[model samples]
Target: MTNNTPRVALVTGGSGGIGRTVVERLARDGMAVGVHYAGNKARAEETVAAVQALGGRAVAVSGDVADEHAMSDAFDTVEREFGGLDVVVNTAGIMLLSPIATLDLDDLDRMHRTNIRGTFVVSQQAARRVRRGGAIINFSTSVTRLQFPAYGAYAASKGAVEAMTLILARELRGKDITVNAVAPGPTATELFLDGKDQAAIDTLAKAAPLERLGTPEDVAESVAFLAGPARWVNGQVLYTNGGVA
Candidate 1:
């Protein structure tokens, strides 16, 4: 199921702050992109339009990342539309913060379902369907290393992602596909800045040795490397933070 065709990439959460940047970057890299969105059809359409405006090929696909059948269909659509599947970037995730002692079990379950189970589902499809020479990039967080006080559950979910990423790379032995995770620290995305006050933001901004928060494009660069040229860098987590750890 391999051919010398133009590279194709499917990016989950392609309408998101970081994911949108990744989609555009890959398009600029000359790959046809399938922008997968969980629910935000309008934003996904906007993303597709942005790519098309740039004279790139793109389509918007909708599916829940945690649903095996939905993701399976999403993959099929991308392969059908783009002629083949090459790179898959799973950036669809949710973060819910809570201290361990007072954590709501329901919140934990919801986060795990999206962050852990959703990643597994998407990775499963990527492993089975991505063409040879393809790449599978998953998202983790620097919070796992920072171990922030209220991030216990969120960190646990990403820990599972880190584990699966390494193991899946080994499982795909003999295939030319690369599997890796990108861990971004305090990136300046709506998801990270939504509820934080100026004081909190300032404190976090100074935490990194570079003395500033990272942008979505900063993380997207790491993803771009793994997806295209970083063939030798596999089964590892690349932290895109400014030496925060």
Candidate 2:
């Protein structure tokens, strides 16, 4: 409301690798941020501390992203603490890999529960609450275009995310809010590097023309652009994959 009030943001899954970087980057952008974590209270607080170390304002909020009521409370906390919300980045998601034939139905369901339903729940609240001139950013994956084997189920879930993200952008027309999704490819994170040998990692690393796996900080820069300065960049899926696709 005042010229001096900093912008506010709520980043789901803010304790994870890429999400953690996003939280700090937004804080660096001068936004008072609400770091939302599903179960890792300690890690979330660590992220809060990192932002504080940077001389930024931050708070850690907890909730399952798929739970409507809990996420509602999380959003309320951000607004209450920071005065108003200007950006919401839904980085909360899970990836389960398998060929469509051998894929466990339960695995597909679990991934869908978190990735699809979770995004909807968070985006619903964001649609209702983010102040005018705010932005909503969602996470998808470049695998949808990469068509990599064993990623069928995961890609399907993210495919739905891409669909919903574009539609939400249009639905928010005239509200001065921008809705978009960032699709990262071959990022080097603990979860990503797990179960892979160095040779395999090197092969995938070179798959991109950039000749290296993407880093969380690399992905965070894209988020920072959308959250702060990319006002006209709405309803687009940014493939932050170093031209792998």
Please count the clashing residue pairs in each candidate, in the order shown. 0, 0
For each candidate, what is the lDDT? 0.95, 0.94
Q: Please, what are the lDDT tens digits per residue for candidate 1 over residues 46-152?
A: 99999999999999999989999999999999999989899999999998888999999999999999999999999999999988899999999998899999999
Per-residue lDDT for 1-245 in model 2, tens only? 45566899999999878999999999988999999999999999999999999899999999999999999999989999988898999999999898999999999999999999999999999999998878999999999999999999999999999999999999999999999999999999999999999999999999999899999999999999999789999999999999999
Model 1 regions more than 4 Å off:
1-4
Question: Candidate 2: how large is its RMSD?
Answer: 0.9
Off by over 4 Å in 2: 1-4
lDDT of model number 1: 0.95
